[model samples]
Target: MTVVTKPKAQPRAFISLRSSVDFVVTSTTSEIIDRALGYLRAGFPVHFRGPAGTGKTTLALHIAAQLDRPVMLMVGDEQLTSSDLVGEQNGYRYRRVVDRYIHSVVKYEEDAVQNWVDNRLTTACREGFTLVYDEFTRSRPEANNVLLAALEERVLVLPTSNGANAYVKVHPDFRAIFTSNPQEYAGVHDAPDALSDRLVTMDLDYYDRPTEISITASNSGLDLAEVERVVDIVREFRDSGEYDQAPTLRACIMIARVSALQGIRPSLGDKRFVQICLDVLESKTAYTSKNRDRRTAQRKMLVQMIDHHMAHPLDAERV
Candidate 1:
């Protein structure tokens, strides 16, 4: 007998979209959207702070598109440097010439020169693009110090050695959107007070249950019933206080998408589907009891919850 094995799929390369983010605006988020647009239009930088998977970055991109300007997205990280935000002098080019003036005489001349490369922030400031600096707090505050002048004084100081080209006036149309998670979250830095004072800061929490259902159903291409079941289970886990990381709508979307792709019904009796949910969500929940093994306790709790929910599903209105 011959056996066949399926090949693993390769990861896709990063591609920036020219079009605006396709977002479904339910009644819950409509007001927030309008308010955010109002702040951006009134010439103030807008900042969105929220937990992971709350769609802060998505909303920022959508708002940027509303401005009818080109979009530039920059993700922050620990290694992000000031030179990365502004322009940097990269390497050098050399020109050399040799001339033979006479039979025994020769002259040689060489010149080396460096050229500046504009990074996302500088280019956005110069060309009036809507800059979305997502998760800006992940980067050290010093790396973002350049923004103080740009946001307030409408100017960006260049790192040029020559005094003549020290700064550029920020284009009148240039706008910025910043996003970050709460400080208690991992890999976050306390934003400088001066910089925070300049932005129109807004807080975002997870969408209401109904909105989450809508978002999960729309994004995952799953039936509403199945998506609801998945969402309910994840929400229960989140509220249980058993996990360090609450399973967000992002986790719901992942489970829904995989199940839809494989035609697996969301059921506790189905070992395969149960395993999928546990694998995607089990590690996120933390154990608070000192005597219990975290991994084992979490696994038992999730299994029991899945079984209970499957047998007696929550009422439609409750979730």
Candidate 2:
């Protein structure tokens, strides 16, 4: 008799092509991969905190993809309810009815099933999918109270229409990942200590120079020289402390793309390109009359950066 053997499953690629399409812009870094692996191995909920435009959402999505799990995403808001995280019961519907006439009063009872629980957390737990809660702390801390037990004990105590006695248990394979800006940013809430203790927070910083330039070049369709120039300019501004808020690689890519679209070339004489950098810095920093001198110094530094870029084209290649 001949026996058939099952084929072994091949390992998934580190970076899937489908996952790449999810984020049009991303700053690739080894730290991101390390954090993803840490979460996967530790079996703990992971939280990503960073400044705005630092690709926290993109990183979360990429990590979810790397885990090779179905992703259920929730964008937190102030109006979010427990039902939004757990589940709610809609009105009951009667599918079958039988009537028998008798001398006594007819007996009737309603039958119901608590089967429809729809929410990111509930569905992820029930289906053993990866849950991405973006800007989770933006909502009231009370809204996430339903998640405490689910995240800690791997069991979701859901509310059902039957009564307080009804609840749904979470599946064992579920995992959660969260991403949010720093609490100092507007519209962010301080994460409750209870929830914070349950998660491993990975504070993400801006991408290092080479990675930033590569990401900007790949996404912006700009030459490496142009990408490096933009990176250098931003890095100088950040290191010099001329601008209170440093422009992110994302901002640099935007400026490059806009410059290219406007027929601006990579040259020091490009006033429009310089203006783009100024606009990014001005919009990101809180302007005040007291910092007028600082602003002027920043503009001078920006001009010097442009001149340096034009004078030494080979310097842009190093990044």
TM-score of each: 0.83, 0.80
Clashes of 2: 0
How does model 2 score by TM-score?
A: 0.80
| Candidate 1: tens digits of C-alpha lDDT, residues 1-319 | 2222333443322224453332577887778879988988888999999999898988887778778887778999999999889978876656666767575877777677665677888888888888899999999999999999999999999888857657878998998999999999989999999999999999999888899999888888888887888898898888888877878889999988898899988875678879988988986855456736877877888988788778854354347
Residue 239, model 2: Cα distance from true site in angstroms: 2.5
Off by over 4 Å in 2: 1-17, 21-28, 94-117, 161-165, 287-297, 314-319
Regions of candidate 1 where Cα sits further than 4 Å from its true position: 1-22, 92-113, 286-292, 312-319
Residue 98 of model 2 has an lDDT of 36
lDDT per residue as tens, model 2, 244-268: 5557877878877777677676677
Give residue 128's error in model 2 in angstroms. Answer: 0.7
- List of clashing residue pairs for candidate 2: none
